[model samples]
Target: MLAKRIIPCLDVKDGRVVKGKQFIHLRDAGDPVELAMFYNEEGADELVFLDISASSEGRNTMVNVVRSVASQLNIPFTVGGGIHSLENIKALLRAGADKVSLNSSAVKTPELITAGSDFFGRQCIVCAIDAKFDKDSGFYRVYIHGGQKRTEWDAIEWAKKAVSLGAGEILLTSMDRDGEKNGFELNLTRKISESVDVPVIASGGAGKLSDFSDVFIRGEADAALAASVFHYKETSVKQVKAYLKQEGVAIR
Candidate 1:
C-alpha cells in the first residue's frame, strides 16, 4: 500500500495566514512564510496554501505569498483560490507550486480541469470540493466561492466527474466539519473516495490523533489535512504520524 500523507493547510486572507470555523469567524494564525517553513521542518508530507478570499474578492491568488512560502518549503505544496485560468496556473507553477487546486473555477468551467491537466499533466491539477451534508436532501452538496456559494452538484458525483476530466487528486473538505475538531465526515469522505479512482485528501475536523487514523483506515483517504489543530499546536505532525503508525497505517 502507498504510504498515507499528512498535510498542513495554510488558509490565507489578505496575505495573512488565518483559521476559521465553518469558513467564517476568521482569526489570525501567523505569517504564511514562517508557518510554511515551520511545517517543512516539522516533517509534513506536503503543504496546502489557499487564499481564502481571493475568489470572493475577484482577484488572482497572492503570487508573492506563494513564491515566498514555496521558497521555504522542501516538501511539495499546492496553491489554490482565485485560480481561474491556465495562465494563472502557469504563473503559480513558475512561482513554485507543485500543484494548483481549482474549486469555483472548475465548477464554473470544468473544461479548465481537462485543459489544465492536458497542458500541465494530471499530477499538477487538484480539484478541491467543499461540501456540506444536507440533512433534508441526504446528499452532500458542493459549495464554492470559499464556501459562500452553494451548487447543486452532489459531492460524490462531482468527484467522479472531476477524475474523468483529468484531475489527478481530490481535496475534499467537509464544510460542516471545518474547525469542529470532532472528526472527519467519514461517510461523506468514504463515499467519495470509493467512487473516484483518484487519490482523495480528506480535510477538516481533525482534532485528536485518532481522527487521523480513523480517516485513513475507515474513510480510506489517501491523505488527511487539518488547520486549527496543527496551527494552534494542539497536536503536531510527528504525533499524528506516530499514532497512525501505531495503528498500522503506513506513513513516510
Candidate 2:
C-alpha cells in the first residue's frame, strides 16, 4: 500500500494566514512564509495554501505569497483559490507550486480541467470540492466562492466527473466539519474516495490524532489535511504519523 500523507493547510485571506470555524469567525494564524517553513521542518508530507477570499474578491491568487511560501518549503505544496485559467496555473507553477487546485473555475468551465491536465499533466491538477451536508436533500452539496455560494452539483458526482476530466487528485473539504475539531466528515470522504480512482485528500475538522487515522483507515483517504489543530500547536505532523503508524496505517 502507498504511504498515507499528512498535510497542513494554510488558509490565507488578504495575504495573511488565517483559520476559522465552518469558514467563519476568522482568526489570524501566522505569517504564511513562517508557517510554511515550520511545516517543512515538522516532516509534513505536503502543504496546502489556499487564498480564502480570492474567488469572492474577483481576483487571482497571490503569486508573490505563493513564491515566498514555496521558497521556504522542501516538501511539495498545493495552491488554490481564484485560479481560473491555464495562464494562472502556469504563473503559479512558475511561482513554485507543485499543484494547482481548481474549485469554482472547474465547475464554471470544466474544460479548464481537461485543458490544464493536457497542458500540465493531470498530476498538476487538483479539483477542490467544498461540500456541506444537506439534511433535507440527504446528500452532500458542493459549495464554491470560498464556501459563500451553493451549487446544485452533488459532491460525489462532481468528484467522479472531475476525475474523468483528468483531475489527478481531489482536495475534499467538508464545510460542515471545518474547524469543528470533532472529526473528519468520514461518510462524505469515504463516498467520494470510493467513487473516484484519483487520490482524495480529506480536509476539515481534524481535532485529535485519531482523526487522522480514522480518515485514512475508514475513510480511505489518500491524505488528511488540518488547519487549526496544527496551526495552534494542538498537534504535530510527527505526532499524527506516530499514531497512524501505531494504528497500522502506512505512513511516510
Candidate 3:
C-alpha cells in the first residue's frame, strides 16, 4: 500500500495566506513564506500554494510569490491559480514549482491541459476542480474563475476528461465544505476517486484528525489537503499522521 500523504495548503492573496468560510469573508492566516518553511520543517509530505484571486482578477499567477515560497521548501510543491498557458506553466515551474495546477483556464480551454501535459509531461500538470452542490441538478457542479463563475459541466465528467487529457492528478476541492471544518466531502471525493485512475488530492472541510483518516480510508483519496486547521495551530500534520497510522491506514 502506498503511504497516504498529508499536505498543508497556503491560499495566498495579496501576498498573505488567508482562509475563509466556503472561500469567502477571507481572514489572514500568516505570511506565505513563513508558513511554507514551517510546513517543510514539520515533515509535511507536500505543500500547495494557491494565489486564490488570480483567476478572478484576470491575471497570471504571482510568480514572485511562487519563487519566494519555493525557495524555502525542499519538498515537492504544487502551484495554481490564474495559470492559462504553456508560458504560464513554464514560468511557474521556473519560479520553483514542481507542478502547476490549472482550473478555470482548463475549463475554458481544456486543450490547455493536453498542451501542458504534452510539453511538461502529465506528472507536472494537475487539473484542479472546484465544486459546489447544485439543488436543481442534485449533483455537484464545477465552479471556475476562482469560484466566481459557474459551469454547466458536471464535476464527475470533468474529472474523467481531465485524466483522459493527461492531467497527472486531480486536486478536488468541495467549495461547500471549504473552511467549514466539518470534514471532507467523502461522498464527492469517493465519487471522483472512483471515476479517475489518476491520484486525487482531497481538499476542504478538514476539522479534526479523524477527518483525515475518514477521507483516506473511506473516500479512498491518495492525499488530504487542509488549511486553517494547520495554519492556526489547531492541528498538526504529525498528529493527523499518527492517528492515521494508529487506525491501520498506511501513512508516512
Candidate number with the higher lDDT (2 or 3): 2
Clash totals, every prediction:
0, 0, 0
lDDT values for all models:
0.87, 0.87, 0.86
TM-score for predicted model 3 compared with the true structure = 0.90
TM-score of each: 0.91, 0.90, 0.90
* Candidate order by decreasing TM-score: 1, 2, 3
Q: For residue 167, what is the lDDT in candidate 3?
A: 98
67 Cα displacement, candidate 2 (Å): 2.2
Residues 134-247 of candidate 1: C-alpha lDDT, one tens digit per residue: 888999999998899999999999999999999999999999998799999899889988998889999989999899999998999999998889877789898998888888
Candidate 1 vs. true structure, TM-score? 0.91
lDDT of 2 by residue, 1-252 (tens): 789999988888777777532322223235777777767777899988888664544244378888887777778999988888899999888899999999999999999999999998999999999999998998999998889899999999999999999999999999999979999999999999999999999999999888898898889899999878876778888898888899999988
Candidate 3 lDDT trough over 10 residues, lowest sum: 20-29
Question: For candidate 3, lDDT tens digit of each residue in 1-252?
Answer: 778899988777766677533322223335667677767777799988887664444234368777887787778999887787899898888888889999999999999999999998999999999999999999999999768899998999999999999999999999999989999999999999999999999999999888998999899999999888987778888888878899999987
- Sort by lDDT, best first: 1, 2, 3
Candidate 2 achieves a global lDDT of: 0.87
Model 2 clashing residue pairs (backbone): none
Top candidate, metric TM-score: 1
